[model samples]
Target: MITNPSTSQLVRSVSTELRAKVLPELTDPALLVEVEMMLSMLDMAAVRADHEIAWMMQEADGIDTALSEAAVEGELPAPVRDALHALQLSRPADLTYPEVQRHYGLASEALARAADQAHAGDERLRSLAWSLLEGRVDHELATIGAYVAVGRSENQT
Candidate 1:
């Protein structure tokens, strides 16, 4: 019987196979470098596949919590208000990529507008927006993890 492998599991298996088998067979320097990059990409893909959905969900929720308060303050710009309103109206129908992506897109827009408001000296909005921005940056940094350039001649350690 065939069992299902999680995306990360499958990606790691392929990466391991490439490193153990294909790497040994690669004779050309250029091909070795290219294959090393491919292995790095596979690692990245595994990490992203495991965490991207949850990160997006957290970011979306953070935006909603922060911007919902700003919406109540009644001082947001027209575009910002509209974006927030759209977020409120457009709940994700499911956890599918397209559904989550649609929700995330609206949240991103709302966050951008709220960030503009914050920059314009809305103190409460500023703190809230900053937290959201930091959370976004954290997610991005986590996805990138370490950036040691594998197989790049200049980055050889």
Candidate 2:
């Protein structure tokens, strides 16, 4: 059986073609800047297409884990507690992007509260919340690094 090109592959091909063919022929500085921005966005999208869902799920799972741990040791704010209970009852693996995003929004609020509590002297909860936040930031930074590397390579070539 034959399969079509994956989304990332298609995006990479287009970005490569634009860089090698179209970019050189363009004379307008403004148009060149626009095209370059488009290329960078496409590159970022391609990277995300390859990993965003997994990252989302991973993030959700981490939030769930942190909430569960926090629940065992201390009291969470009402909104966070409710959101965590809802998350626990649902299957995260079955969630779509929008659903995950909604849950993530709730988790963010809960995390913020957790951070506040942590600063108020709850070291255990603070550690868990910060771990989740740090992991997320690291993931984002990796994606940004990939885009920056692509931009650097384009500049070099």
Candidate 3:
């Protein structure tokens, strides 16, 4: 059995070759900017290929935790009650991307539905959900890594 080069390696290899071989001979400003955009997309693709699944799984886990806590609270708000009912349904049997994506969607929806209730244990669950959302923002920031439009007027320096 042979292992394949990772998406990051493949994309970086192509980008590097293009930078070394192609960029040197290119004189068109428009084309140079376009190539830069393409390189940025390739970089993003590499990062997503490496980390998207793990991030999704982590978010799903956090959402499930919140839902589980919300489910047990007495006199639950309608959103929490509905989310708890929705969550009681079984998740997908397979753990493929599409299946996991579907599972994440359902769980995320459940958590969003219960985001506003601030009574009793509901407040704790909402707080947990807020923390999870903050973590999600952190993950996204890590993924995008302080992106700024490179060719923008403000970026001209």
Best TM-score goes to which candidate?
A: 1
lDDT (tens digit, per residue) of candidate 3 on 96-153: 7787787778777776766666434566666766776788888788777768685565
TM-score of model 3 (CA atoms) = 0.75
Q: All candidates' lDDT scores?
A: 0.83, 0.75, 0.71
TM-score of 1: 0.84
Candidate 3 positional error at 46, Å: 0.8
Considering lDDT, which of the candidate structures 1 and 3 is the better prediction for this target? 1
Model 3 error, position 53 (Å): 1.2
Poorest lDDT segment (10 consecutive residues) of candidate 1: 148-157
Q: Give the TM-score of candidate 2.
A: 0.77
lDDT top scorer: 1
Q: Give per-residue lDDT, candidate 2, residue 45.
A: 82
Give candidate 1 misplaced runs (Cα > 4 Å). 1-4, 119-124, 153-157
Residue pairs with backbone atoms closer than 3 Å in model 3 (clashes): none
* Candidate 2: regions farther than 4 A off: 1-4, 92-95, 116-124, 146-157
Task: Give every collision pair in model 1.
Answer: none
Residues 1-157 of candidate 1: C-alpha lDDT, one tens digit per residue: 2167998889989998888888988778887888888888888898989998888888888888777776686677787889988988888898888898889999999999888878987776788888899999988788777886767678542
lDDT of 2 by residue, 1-157 (tens): 1156988888888999999999999877667777888898888788887887778778777888878887887777666687777777655445577776766666666677777767887767777878888988987876665444333346643
lDDT of 3 at 63: 72
